[model samples]
Target: MNGLDLGVVGNGTIAGLVNSVGNYQWLCLPRFDGEPVFNKLLGGGGQFDIWMDGLVSRSQSYDTNTAILRTRLEAEDGAVMEIIDFAPRFETRGRVFRPASIVRRFHVVSGTPRIRITLTPETDWGDRKLPAVRGVNHIRFNDGELAFRVTTDAPVSYVLSGTSFLLEQDVSFILGADESLTDTVDVITLDWEERTRQYWTKWARSLAVPYEWQEAAIRAAITLKLCVFEETGGIVAALTTSIPEHEGSERNWDYRFCWIRDAYFTVTALNRLSAMGTLEHYMRWVRNIVAQSKGGHIQPVYGIGLESDLTEEYATHLPGFRHTGPVRRGNQAAEHIQHDVYGQVVLGVSQSFFDSRLISRPGIAEFRQLEPVGERAFAVHDTPDAGIWEFRTIAEVHTSSAIMCWAACDRLSKIAAHLGLPDRATYWSERAAIIHKTILEKAWNPKVGAFTASFGGDTLDASVLLMAEIGFVPASDERYVATVDAIDSTLREGNHVYRYKTEDDFGRPKTAFTACTFWHIDALYRVGRVEESREMFESVLSSRNHVGLLSEDFDPSTGDLWGNFPQTYCMVGIINSAALLSKPWSEVI
Candidate 1:
């Protein structure tokens, strides 16, 4: 019965997903793409759990305006325990001290609560068990190149043997590097917790969130921030990988790497909140990728460290999420000719040229480098590729890809104008106009009375909603409005929105693409259906997990979240919808 009802904690360097019951179910050590030390979320054998005797009820939530999570467990005998989980993140010395670590503090609320600690870590995607070497105050887990230590004040014997013990005093567990602690566990953990709490609260206070749904906006912003790899500025699509889009669909794919499209939306959402740090870092990452590409073809996805060859493979050793097989380790989309990526890269990096708050601004050199990307986008605007959906067998000149290509040219023109290069601006603007005209004629199917997924196709695609969103089409235009209505009547199922109705590589999409639903909501608001948009937005907001987190997909009938845990796409949707649907601060305050 394990589900996506999970809470995430990270320090920007590494992240861990804790299930509702206070188990460290999914954690990648050292870095986001490092080995999975706790893989039970994918039905593997590694986990860290706190079991209370005679448990009756349990609930989980984040500490206000922080990445810290609190799971409250109450026993039938009136014993209560609260476990505080976070990866320590705060400024230390002259730099930020965000290490690859997780801290768990156990506080007994009532009576003498008896609890048992289970800490088991595996390696090689749960294919091998790590050997533990116990010290007086710590246990070092070693698995070849992978090694970390757990320092605890609780008895090592009790933890190792899983023996039930009375929790009369507050305890602490620090899972981090192999180095020993310098101070007492209680002293250092308390200090780290307070400092981390202050750090997050201070960071949250800086966000310019919407008047309404402020809490959802802040939580989504924080979760999106957690997905960032501070070391390289690359943002992961999600923390854990291989979770099926729908159970038994075998649509599982690894989302550990950074996708240009996902990162574009992620930065755009965070940018709305005035959380510019992530954008700054991500722009740096994008710059690195662009520089390495040397104006050549750019992959849709890459490792956080900018490793490009993300060859997809199945980890036959471990069973998939919910016992579905084929736990994929890498994404094959890295090899896909996802032309939309050209636009995504330009769009994601465009903020650097416009935003003056950034430490490093893009100048003529950067503009010169980006011109080649714009050239490629214009060249491939009408070509066939995998599309945004990344269909395996079919190749179509997807409308989404074409529009994004248009976006690349449009943004490049604006950037060129900003740089005072009128000739270059005119060149890019003219190319954008050509792409725009082509899409208007080819992508719009008069038979369906809407813009289809691809040229000359009669099928409806949720991504077409982005036409109005990206300003390729006006919201008030009859064609865009009719497209929205057509999709509303076809692909939308109540509050949920499917990406498309047609079967492709998979038989058919069985669950709602969480982000597409948000796009639909945004489109409704833009089309002046304010009340309906707000109602639908609320419905999707209610679908979030207990800790206000969302996955990539959702089961409309069962209300179960599926796909990757803590999906960046879904988190971005929450922020974008809240920003669009929320009332203005002048009206509210």
Candidate 2:
């Protein structure tokens, strides 16, 4: 597939991915799930790019503790230039100034250098490249319904003609709504840049981070926060979609929607770091989803705007990533009965009741709303449905899904008691006890010597490693320990782990799922295998790209990351593992 070596900058309302050479390869206007205006990441679509014409060497990184990207380009002639790109976000006049805009600053650091600007944007997912109407200091591109304007100090002729002009003074470009910029470009951009930097830095300062690998954990935390659409309190799985998990595997998926399974893991990690703002907002969203679920049947995923009918369809007009055909929008998995979501939804909201930092703690009404969720979990505790993997043609009584259901009931009992309801607590506790017994009896395999993927099946699934994670079983318990060993022997290839080895809808998976590897690390740490866990954690940390970001999966043989950019699950693994494995805070002092 085409490479996704881009850093993302977002302001909750909008996001963009800037390539190593300073091109916005993928960006959706208005919101994360909105139609793409720059579709070059999918191939053969319009893009917005700015780079030195004679650039030979380049390096890029996010400004420390912030999502702002800084790329330095050095030409062969010894001229140097730096590009500062960020979506302006900060507090102004007692409110957040998070507009649907991206501010870029071009600085000449050394010898005279010429630069080029390409502001071509395709309307309606690259169906056509719309033309721009230029003025003295700004240019406007419209698709009839919406208009995208670029106001810059650079000459319009030099930009349109792709002609390089001498870089005498620093230039700033503001890409936003179609409104005139009355203030000077440098003045407005500089102010926003400073405010954005301070905002992110202060946010990072509030995190209760581990001493070792603090930077990695911080970057992962910031990236996860960027995935949140603050307006709706929805968190996307990843920034860019349609990037395949493996080569020619047809495992490509659009991760722009929020999944209960993924969001649960994300909030769990943020909770460990004391980042309660995201958790509070996410719980608000989860409360709504739980209320909307009819008879406790929750979809695995939903649009950021909470749109339910995400029917999958292919955008065949544009070539797929790296020309892999059948680029898809919407998701078919939404239709499947992924039972793990009920448990995940409960787990995500349970934290609000205990976290004092949350603006509003869930009380009696929220507990009443969750009754249907526990009821459905108990009803389908042993029933068969699509597992977490979302196998299209096969259905089985997945052990992991059931375990999640058990967790749902287990947490419900505690939440009920927390609300001073003794009878309700006893009701949920009884259901949880039954589920606990059923999982131990039906899911455990005598010959395999551990819990299998499904009841009465011998296939091993690495997700079962979560037995210790979700408190389904104690790490010291022989059954849980034996299950970890079973997964280690069957699914682990070197330090990495695969979700499963069995052939499924597509075929055998060839790469290691990055998050599963982290699960293994956390499992080891939980079981007191500190030495081994540390070694494995270091190995997985090395798997990140140059800028310390991870995708969904990785090729163990080649150490090349594959799948969506800045995957929420994979990044959560980084934060969770670091928090679990890091030495005591007293030592750092």
Give per-model TM-scores: 0.99, 0.98
TM-score of 1: 0.99
Candidate 1, superposed: residue stretches over 4 Å from native: none
Instruction: Give a tens-digit lDDT track for model 1, residues 318-421.
Output: 88788987799889999989999999999898888999998888899889888889989999999999999988889999999999999999999999899999
Measured by lDDT, the strongest candidate is 1
lDDT of 1: 0.92
- Summing lDDT over every window of 10 consecutive residues in candidate 1, give the lowest-scoring window: 1-10
Q: Point out where model 2 deviates above 4 Å.
A: none
